[model samples]
Target: MKTMESIENEEAAPRAEHQTETPLESLASIASVLAVGLFVMTFVFQNFEIPSASMVKTLLIGDHVLVDRISLAPPAKWAPFTFYRDIHRGDVIVFLKPGEPDLFLVKRAIGIPGDHIHLRNGVVYLNGVAQKEPYAAMPTSDGDPQHEYNPYRDDFPSIPPDPMYQVTASWQYELPQHIENGDLVVPPGKIFAMGDNRPDSLDGRYWGFVPRENIVGRPMFVYWSFETPADQIEKQSISERLAFMGHILVHIVDQTRWKRTFHLIR
Candidate 1:
């Protein structure tokens, strides 16, 4: 029943204030908010993606985690010698990878200052006592790769001569015969950490202890997660434009794991 002039006038009417933002404007506002979030996240809380499965079960691939940044310093981008707090065992931490300053890694605290640690049959022992690790949700079954890469070595790819290799029964970091429990130092301001996936993890064992300053932040929680299609995760791809587009759409939609939406990262 509306006349053409009336309809045109109605269409020309000003929109609500909240609805005035254009798509680009909405994007800009979102970006501004994200920038503010990053500033706070970098200095206050940190956001990271679990790109690898080294900490699987505790942290999964594609899981987004947040970390508190008030505690660590020294090597972090913030300020030097500004130790706001202390790191503790059992706390999940993210750190600048030892030896490789360019890369960052996340793991759980296993050894502390002055704690003698050893790996027996690929199990961790603290102060000569077997420390039960409950966070390792999956049963350890993989064979140890003895030639694990030691990053600290200038040779780069050569394996280090660790005493752990000398054990006759199983894989373990055999403490020196004379190095008593007190000699097992994590140093004055260093921490020893390992991934929950012990066998697959490249951690303190391969690169030496991580300096306290190298720590990035403690992982907070899962903010976002992406699902890998059981078949597509490891699938190789083509370089063609149309083919690649088809591949990407299939990868995103078919792989969208509905059950994992908003799932918390442990």
Candidate 2:
């Protein structure tokens, strides 16, 4: 028969064992959690910030958005549960800039593959039909005699583009090849993207078409919006971004766009 002291020791032994876990075991648990988080962030969703005024009233600078990466992900043979929806016209998308692959850009998808796109008097026409753009910001040119109308902004795809609206050299070379009956024909595997604030944007009309593979995802909502200038938001380095986040934390009340926070992106 065990003595009282022995029984007490037995109970204490289990308590001690339960409390003591090896450092390696603890590390493995942490690593597992981190791995899952990283996988979700890389393939399921990601955070993006608006760095320019090109999307203006629709998406303002300093707006932090959550993008659903899975919706546009390439189909995987091994992942049967994964689903994909076609990218339709009028969908706002975030994609890698054609000229600068590292830079991510957000714009409305104006033309899909094989679409005949054009613009006239600052209005977009897709497939020979005028698109209803209720979200476009105030027009920069209100027929002011002092403000010279930019041909490229008011009218697009003139055989010999106006020198005033000189496009990128690469786009200049490719623009003519896609012209069909005066409209810019989007080639297969490419999409034409433009900003809601057309007058201030340097989009497909300036750079070139957005390749299929370059598209990242569609923004689900504005998780947070801060009143910050375009120049400050353009800083992309890790240290710079961290510093900017810290600034937001300190000046949250004053800089936060409270009305826009948690706003759904259309």
TM-score of each: 0.61, 0.87
RMSD of each: 8.9, 3.1
Model 1 residue 239 CA deviation (Å) reads: 6.3
The digit string of per-residue lDDT tens for model 1 on 100-208 reads 6888898988877777665545556667676677766333334434324323221211233354533222113322321353234466677888888765566665556
lDDT of each: 0.63, 0.85
> In candidate 2, how many clashes are counted?
0
Q: Best TM-score goes to which candidate?
A: 2
Deviating ranges (above 4 Å) for candidate 1: 1-35, 71-84, 137-184, 229-254, 257-266
Q: Which pairs of residues collide in model 2?
A: none
What range of 10 consecutive residues in model 1 has the weakest lDDT sum? 149-158
Instruction: Return the lDDT, model 1, position 192.
Output: 82
What shift in Å separates residue 73 of candidate 2 from its native position after superposition? 2.2
